[model samples]
Target: MNRDGAAPTMKGGQFNTDPIAAPNEAATAALSQAEFELFAELGRPRAVEAGQVLFRRGELGTTMFIVASGAIDLDFGDDLVTKRLGPREFFGELGLLIGDHARSADAIVAGAGLLIELRHEEFQRLVDRNPGLVCHFLRRAIMRVVLNEQGLIRRLRRRNQDLEAALDSLYATTHQLNQTEELIRTDELTGLYNRRGLTLRLQESRAIGMPASLGLVLVDCDRFKQVNDDHGHLAGDRVLQAVASILRSVAGPEDVACRLGGDEFCLLVASSNAGDVMRFAEFIVATAQNLMLMPQSPPAMCPVSVGACMVDPRADWNDWYARADEALYQAKRKGGNRVHWQDAALEPV
Candidate 1:
């Protein structure tokens, strides 16, 4: 019997000469009794022991084998299923048909038995003596080669599809993660950087030693609570959005406009000049005052106080915030709607 535990059968419904048979025997490369006996007479017999390797994959082969009384295993490797041939079954026909052909698999003996080894010369003699029978075996061998090629192509196609799907899934997951990170650091109402976003930006800039010199400007909507009380919170939100827009307009390309919280906004300017920071702060205040004079002014329009200061790289965010806030307090103390800025000199600890 073959590895499938089925009795080997002959072609054309003839009884297989082997004592054992193969179940569901469709078309095989096994030889009939007469063919085997004839080849046995022409070919040399090799006595093989279990675990003996007849030939390794990739070696140049010029011979074929017919299992006379034992089994042999063909290990194709690379996860391909191994095939076992029992008595009367033949393998490695390609080597005989195509001289110097590379062996595709390792042929190892599964048990101690005799194998009929046929070289190219012996195969030629058999073809001359019995052309019809040799032609049938050749056809079966060719069919097996075609079938194996088709099967390998199908498996490779499936693996390629699976790899593409995995790559697509990974791309989608990365896109979603990026969007989520943006949302976390963004202000929904003003579409500006939130507090966390501003802090992160500053940290990143420092890490890269960018923006050789920096400045911070803080702005506060004057009498914001009164604006919410006079109009509704909705109007107050619109007012804040308008202020954010003004800051955005005044900020440079490398600058960051952020709404820290509530009615407070800030700008991280990529400049060290106190005059530049003061000018930015003044521009914001003037813009807000101008907004109130517009025909379609914001509801319960109010002016905003501004503070400006150059940053000291050695200092932390808290120090920067405190210095800017103090200047803002000074502007507000002057009855709001104005700008105040500190000197570029570093403050003593």
Candidate 2:
């Protein structure tokens, strides 16, 4: 796993022990056998018992440790994250030579662990005494830091790719889920809101606590089945698209327009007054009629009948919708192409 908390591997049992492969060895040459012997004199090898914590997370790390013969376990925490290190593999140099930063993980003895530790001050003194070695050691230190950073970078890049792929997969899955949801909520033939979508929208509109009023519109295509029977399903689809376009253009940004199966459509308007809704509905009716005057799409002429209901300050949304539906039925019954308003006395408008 990386810093992003992604687990790359299940087990925490990776260890490297070749002395030649130790990070920052380019500087190690300066510390000849004699100088290294000096370090041995200054510091001593320490042994830690199994399961014992050698260093803890968040504590200032000063000394650097090199595994001599045994292995050490690094724990991230109760998350059970651990990394193992064997002979010659070292850690803590990043914090030791730079500004004091807390240790990122806790190091514990895997079984019996033997480690050589070099205190910061003693190590610095040796570097200071051997100025020529300073340059080489600095280069080595930089390489180690770079390697650690690169490892982390590589891990992060991999994780990002994985997350991106996962997100795309999730999007595809959600799209399929949405199609399934639409099947449940939408009319198959007209691509309009079935009864389910209208109910959901009504419920959602009511759920929001707003001070403003709400508006509803119910629309029916004038002589829809006649066009379908005369021009065929393709022409019927064109008519639906034309009316849908008109509705989309006329409705407010916050408003929702949905096909309510067959030739009927509905609109939900929030935070608006009855007058605005009426004007919008009028626009829809007029625009749809104008479109019908154009060259008939293939073979059918399409026009729409619109009916609207506005919210009453004191009436329930259900009652308002019922009145709107009544008005729509009335528009169809009285005339094929016209607009009607809900009786304010019957509900909220």
Candidate 3:
């Protein structure tokens, strides 16, 4: 679109004399007064017919033309994508200023046109004499380069902001996933490891072949259902929590305790000997017996039966657990508050 008031002139025999039709005329006239006089002496107005080709792509040229009226279409490619220029717009100056280089784009008449042709040799001589005109063109080129730089900076800033947002979202999602994993592998009532967690750790222990011996201790709160019925489920939960605290206090750092279900719990002690397992079971029984006399109502006494067995790597986890469970039954049979140990060879004793 022609924002300025310049218009193209017809190509045929029509000629224009108006000076306002040329872009930057006032500046050019002031800078090239002597050359303007020379142009008036040597050159004449030229006319171009409608639909005529002004310049073809790749055509070697040494002159530039300024539109005096009408419009010309610029074609950069075969798809015919064209940009229309009108009214004082100039073209062919780039090739003219640079040597006999071929035109990069085709220029054709959109309508009948009038133009003022300036020979490159004369224009160069004029610019050499008038430094002001050369400075003005140079200033314009620098301004265009600065504007392009600003546009690129804006795009880069937007991309950086988007990347930061994406990273923040990913971090939040990972934190939530960790919390979910903890909940899934923990016992809600006793705050101890669940079966799944114990199994996983056991596999890792076996894989490493660390300490030679591992032991499982099975524990059952005596008459736990009676406690729940007499004192309500809340009191039973408090009792479980207290018992878990005591176990944690006694267990070694390498040991793990798991709540199997309801009132049953299990402990896995790494690298513990048969004597250590026996002593730990005895400690559990004595601790629970002492808690029985604490001034809590409803549940008659806090007491437990414990059974332990050394793990056999040659056997499956279930088989190891079953032996410990049978030993616990034997302890309960003997009395509700006692400790029992299973033979490492797992004979039916």
Candidate 4:
């Protein structure tokens, strides 16, 4: 007797946990009606009461039971009954076939039932009288083992596929999250870093110890309000976009380009010295000077006043911003369209 009680031989001679042919079960263990009746004759009839414990799991089983009328419930002491044997069904035969076998599951009469119990002595007597019984039992027993193993393998494969799908879904979600976070820190208008992005860059720069020169460049479009009034706000917007383009082209991926709103834009560059900062500022000043707003409006020179400063490792981010602001103020005072760089380390651009 096993967890599924016993296997029944189906048409064409096959065995399964249940007698019915199932796509999931084994091939049929076919037997003639005469042979089945001869087998059934080996059992002795017994009346079982409803709630009667016929046999229990782990007991050294010596007898097999066949359900003649009513039903038999199979359990393993748990409330979830595993199987129910109805009319014309047989179970526990494996125990009788194999000498000194222990019952793998418990059998209880579901209701008042008519059962035929066949002991090992009766089974042996039948085998002696008709040796064909030995052949039938061996063939059906082997088929049961094969079919059960195949079922377990199929279940395991399905479980592995589910786990793989879960892992792929997790990876896709993580990638989407990364892209969303990148968008959150980006400016909608110019595709540049926003103020929040710039602040994060500053924090990263400050975290690094000395021997690093962090560069800051402030680019302000000179007389930007006059452009809006002259051509319209659209023109002013175009001017600002042009400035952002120039700054982006001059900065590397390691550098951060940001629009600080209004006519102010900033760049944070990873520089080895002050010269790198000055060269970047010069490129912005040169490119912006050649910008043409419209063909109708005489070449509108959108000159940008740039203020460049190198970070003092000992100084904080605010100190560097203040120095860059002062440099920008100097460039504005000296008439826009020029670079005012602090530190005599780099010549005025």
Q: Estimated TM-score per prediction?
A: 0.78, 0.62, 0.60, 0.61
Question: Evaluated with TM-score, which candidate comes out highest?
Answer: 1
**lDDT of model 4, residue 117:** 78
Greater-lDDT candidate between 1 and 2: 1
Candidate 1 lDDT, 266-322, residue by residue in tens: 998988676777778878888888888875534635799988888887788899899
Worst 10-residue lDDT window, candidate 4? 17-26
> In candidate 4, what are the lDDT values of residues 1-349, reduced to their tens digit?
2222224546467533233333233233333343345556777889989999987888888787767788888875533337777765566766777756777678888878788777877766777866765555445556665665676578668778978999999999999998887777777777888888777766775677444667889989999988988888877877777788888898887788999878899998878767778889998898776664345463344778999988775787679789999999999999989999987766675
Candidate 3 stretches with Cα past 4 Å from truth are 1-134, 203-211, 298-301, 344-349
Q: Could you tell me the lDDT of residue 220 within candidate 3?
A: 90
Report lDDT per candidate: 0.80, 0.67, 0.69, 0.73
Q: Which pairs clash inside model 4?
A: 12-30, 13-28, 13-29, 13-30, 14-28, 14-29, 14-30
Best by lDDT: 1
Give RMSD (Å) of candidate 3 vs. truth.
Answer: 10.3
List per-candidate RMSD values in Å. Answer: 5.0, 8.8, 10.3, 8.3
